[model samples]
Target: MAQTISVAGLRKNYGDVRAVDGVSFEVDQGEFFGILGPNGAGKTTTLEIIEGLREADEGTVAVLGLPPWPRNSRLLPRIGVQLQASSFFERLTAREQLQTFGSLYGVPAKKADAMIETVGLTDKADVRVEKLSGGQAQRLSIACALVHDPELVFLDEPTAALDPQARRNLWDLLREINTAGRTIVLTTHYMDEAEILCDRVAIMDRGKILRLGPPASLVRGLDAPTRVSVASGVLAEDEAKDLPGADEVSDDDVSLTISTRDPSAVVAALSARDALDGVQIRGATLEDVFLDLTGREYRA
Candidate 1:
């Protein structure tokens, strides 16, 4: 596949704080690329620079083989954007909003309605923008971005503030959109969302990308031990140490956390003694890998 976007030695500074420092990455054509990080991690700054909304202090950014800076006229029509919050005419109906946005791109009103249907807001097509719920508003924002049928889309925290069900619904819509062949670059603080949606993700912090790869590959490279939690610490230190495949155990009298690569062996040891109540075992995850690197998990 061809490269859709590329950033090299990207740097941005705000007085004393280096917002984006020496970052570089390439997004493949038609790939669902994600930037995952905690708040204040320079994710938005990096994205804005690539979107041509903000100029970097230094470095190079290219989208579709054109410089994104200065907001190139030739490039704008090929790019779509959905920010964390999108503003629209309060009195305009959902369908009307799309038509208005499409007009800027020379897209006809009929095309606008088709885009609205594409985002699944046809039922509320005539509803005013203000009357729409949070999820509905988000769907409308996506429709507006897609009104021109742009080749690449940038979504900043698209599912933020939505309930679980609404978030899942948006996820389904996003998958459908990607399946139709539009490349998507998404920035999200939710690790699970990135893991599920992104073909590859760049984990960033303090203006730097610490890791870049598939979520499964990143987790697998950790070489970290599996974690097992039990309801109570019934086994003594000596006993737990002798259990098959048990590497480490932290017992607090009220709960037990065992670290081991062979979870089944440890579970078998616990269950054989009728001490398996509330037992839970988990392998390493993206969050765990992040915690190991930064000593903190991704923020909301």
Candidate 2:
């Protein structure tokens, strides 16, 4: 597939702080790509540069074979951007907001109103922006970005403020859009969201990419031990430690967890001992890979 967005040696600085440091990546046409990072990790900065919202101090960015800086008018009609913070025209109803945004791209008012249904805000279509809940406002902002039917969409922490149900609903909506051939670039703090939605993800920290690959591939490459947990009191800690293939064991009252490279052996031993109650065998996940790369230290 052809590249929809490309960045080479991208750099951005905010006075003494380097917000983005030599970032380079590509998003292919119709692909769902994710940028994962903690706060101050440069995900938003890199996104802004590619969306033509901010200028990069160094390196190049091409959106659909055109430069993104200088506010490329040609690119504007072909791309949609949903910022991390939802912003809308003051006092406009949800339907009216969509209609107004769609008008800028020559979309009809009726078509725009229909998009309100797309984001599951049909009942709230008449509600003012400020009156809507955080999730509803988020849905409206997403609808506005998508009202133009742009081929490429940029979503910056699109579900940050949403409840679990709302987040899953938006995830379904995004999957539908991507399935319909729209390329999507997403920046998110949720590891599970990135793992579920992205075809490939770039994990960034301290203004640099620490790892980049498909979520499953990255997790498999970690070679981390699998963890098997069962209800506490299944066996004494000493007995658990002596279980076949157990590399490490710990009990936290609620559950007894055994970490082992040979999960099959450990599970078989647990089965033999009839200690399989509440058993949960878990392998390495994207979050594990993320923590391994970025460390557990909180980022501000």
Candidate 3:
């Protein structure tokens, strides 16, 4: 498959601090790729370099096979970018915003209007930007980005302020976009969103990618323990420890929890003991792998 975006030895610095350090990655044509990390992890810096918004201190980037530096006009029409903090033409209606953005690429007014419905903003088309809720404004921004139907799109924390329902709606819209052969490069802090939407993800921290792969594959590589929980007193803490394959066991007033590598063995033992009441089994997730790679310290 052809490459939509490519980066090699990408580096960027601000004053004495290195924002991006020797980062490299590629986004395949029509692939849903995610860059995930905590705050100030260099995700935005790397994305800016690829989007031609900022120049890299070192390294090369090709967006649609053309260097994305010095403000490449040729690449502008082929790519769409949405920042975490969406900026709109002040006082413009949602419909007007899309029309204005589409006009930049010579897209027709009707086409831009259609995008309003695509992003589920038809009823809010006449609503002024200032009157819209955060999630509603987010939908409008996304519609603006897509009104021109660019081949590649960059979304930075697209669902950041959205409510759960709104976030899931946008996810569906994004899936449809990728299904229609548009390449999407997304940066998000939501591990579940990346795990669900991205074909592959690069986990970054301290200006470098620590792990890169499909979410499931990365989680599988973690070999982390599975957690099994049941109602309190379903089994004594000592009894859980004696269960086959149990690595650790703990009991709170509300629940008894067991951690084990062999979930099947633990589950079988629990079943034999008739202690499966209110059972919940959870395997490792991308979030677990992310924490394992990035550590638990909070990032601002």
Candidate 4:
């Protein structure tokens, strides 16, 4: 696939803080790319730079083969963006708001109504902005973003405050957009959302990317193997070590963490000694990879 967005050695700073430092990545045409990070990890800064909202101190960025900074006039018409938080005229109805945004993008009012329907907000078209629920408001924001029928869309925490069902609804909407050949670039703190929506993700922290790959590939890269937990009995850590392929044993609250690639072998060994009171094996997940890479330290 052709590259729709490219960043090379991107850098940005605010006073003494380097919000984004030498970040580089690419979003292919029609692909869903995600930036995953903790709060204040520069995900938003990096995204803003690409969206032409902020300037980069160093490096280059190309959105649709045009420079992203200084508000590329030609590129602006081809891209859509939904900000993290959106506000509207309190008295304006949903249809009126869409019309206003559509006018700004040179889209016809007729086109705006179509977009309203696209976002499933037609029933609320005449309702005032202040009367809409959080999810309804979010849908309106998305509709405004799509009013221009952009080839690429930037969604910043689109599901942040939505209920579970609302989030799932938005996910389906996004999938429909992607299926129509619109590439999506999103920044999200939700791990499950990234795992489900993103084709590939870059994990960022302290203004740097620690890892980047498909979610499944990154999980597999951990190479930690499946873990089997069993209630602690008379088994010592050393005794558990006797089990084949048991790399480490950790105990807490009468439970043991038996790390081994071969769960069957470990289970058979425990069964042979009649020590298997309770055992459960599970594969690693994206959360485990995040914890292992970033450590358990709380980042403020």
Tell me the lDDT of model 4 at 43.
Answer: 94
TM-score of each: 0.91, 0.98, 0.98, 0.87
lDDT of 1 by residue, 253-281 (tens): 77788899998989998889777878888
**Quality of model 4 by C-alpha lDDT:** 0.90
Q: How close is candidate 1 to the true structure, as a TM-score?
A: 0.91
What are the Cα lDDT values of the candidates? Answer: 0.90, 0.93, 0.93, 0.90
Off by over 4 Å in 1: 230-242, 250-256, 274-279, 297-300
Report, for all candidates in order, the number of backbone clashes: 0, 0, 0, 0
Sort all candidates by lDDT, best to worst: 2, 3, 1, 4
**Candidate 4 collision pairs:** none
Off by over 4 Å in 3: none
> Model 2, 155-175: lDDT tens per residue?
999999789998998899999
- Candidate 3 Cα deviation (angstroms), residue 9: 0.3
| Residue range 1-300, candidate 4, lDDT tens digits | 899999999989999999999899999998999998888889999999999999999999999999988988898889999999997876999999999999998889999999888888889999999999888999999888899899999999999989999999989998888999999998997888888988999999889999999999999998868888888874677899888878878888678879888888988898887777777788888888877877778877
For candidate 3, lDDT tens digit of each residue in 222-288? 9999999999988889888999999999888898999999999999999999999999999999999
lDDT of 3 at 6: 86
